[model samples]
Target: MTDTSKNETNATGAPVTDEAPNTASADVEALQARVAQLEKEVAEYKDQWLRAVADYKNVKRRTDQERADLIRGASAGLILKLLPVVDDLERAMNSVTPEVYASQWYSGFKLIPQKLQTVLDSEGVTPIAAVGADFDPNFHEAVIYEAAGEGQGGKVVAELQKGYMQRERVLRPAMVKVGQE
Candidate 1:
């Protein structure tokens, strides 16, 4: 048996090997098998690369959402701190006498509180309902319990200090007086 790939011609110029067909078929099969293996490996690597890119995109999207949320709610702490001042202003307005209420100074004082409320409204800060509504632990903190009429048990009778919410989060839980039988 001659190795046809390196076979030399005899003096008559005829090749010595009789295995041309077998050699060609075997070489074709080997080349076909190598091509298939390369294709399979390429497909596997492409799948992995696609998954990695998708994972990176998902992480980037999540980070962007978190950053936006942080920027949107950055004023929450300052608003929380200023609520006590707002409460004091409201109390002062409630304690004013009719004589003082008609004075220029009283009107100016009233406008200040109104401006504070306007500022709160502009920031999406909203006052939680306490009076007459059912007492909710999520929105109200019961500081004192008071006597209630029928059908009013477990309801808020008064708000000692107003509670506030920014967006959907409770910035301050309303200090309230709950009523019971």
Candidate 2:
């Protein structure tokens, strides 16, 4: 005397209901939605991490450049200060006549300037080409403009003071006399 109206049963007496398929389908849909949400979150996190890594690389590159610039700048200042001494030495050496330069003491004077040049070279210092080159304000400061002939016009005819650079950056512009055509 089982009540047939209360529940419907299959062959082994398990209750069968019309809502079962709907319930299982709803659960599957919910699980699929959760999976999609998690995937989106993962994608977002990955994007953020990649951006952070890229930012770090940029910062590192900037830091290295700054460090190199600082080192170069420090040397530039020191070299600028020493330029006058080098100029004086050159002047002294040039003033000596060829006969006087042949003296034993002259060798010592020559060595001093050569050693200074070697130090300057090792520090990446270079002289700006002023005499005979086209006068450029970036590398030469015009001290005077003089009348010139033919090819000498608009070019540096004389360097009043030698200009120097450190690693391509101008430490001082060369004082020059420019030719006026």
Candidate 2 colliding pairs, count:
0
RMSD of each: 4.2, 3.1
Q: Where is model 1 more than 4 Å wrong at Cα?
A: 1-16, 97-100, 103-111
TM-score of each: 0.80, 0.85
Q: Output the TM-score of candidate 2.
A: 0.85
Which one wins on TM-score?
Answer: 2
In candidate 1, where is summed lDDT lowest over 10 consecutive residues? 2-11
> Global CA lDDT of candidate 1, please?
0.90
Per-residue error (Å), model 2, residue 161:
0.6
Clashing pairs in 2: none
Worst 10 residues of 2 by lDDT: 2-11
The per-residue C-alpha lDDT of model 2 at residue 176 equals 98
Error of model 2, residue 54, in angstroms: 0.5
| Total backbone clashes of candidate 1, pairs 3 or more residues apart or in separate chains | 0
State each model's CA lDDT, in order.
Answer: 0.90, 0.92
lDDT per residue for candidate 1 within 8-114, as digits (tens), equals 77679867566767998999999999999999999999999999999999999999999988876678877887899998988888898999988998877778888
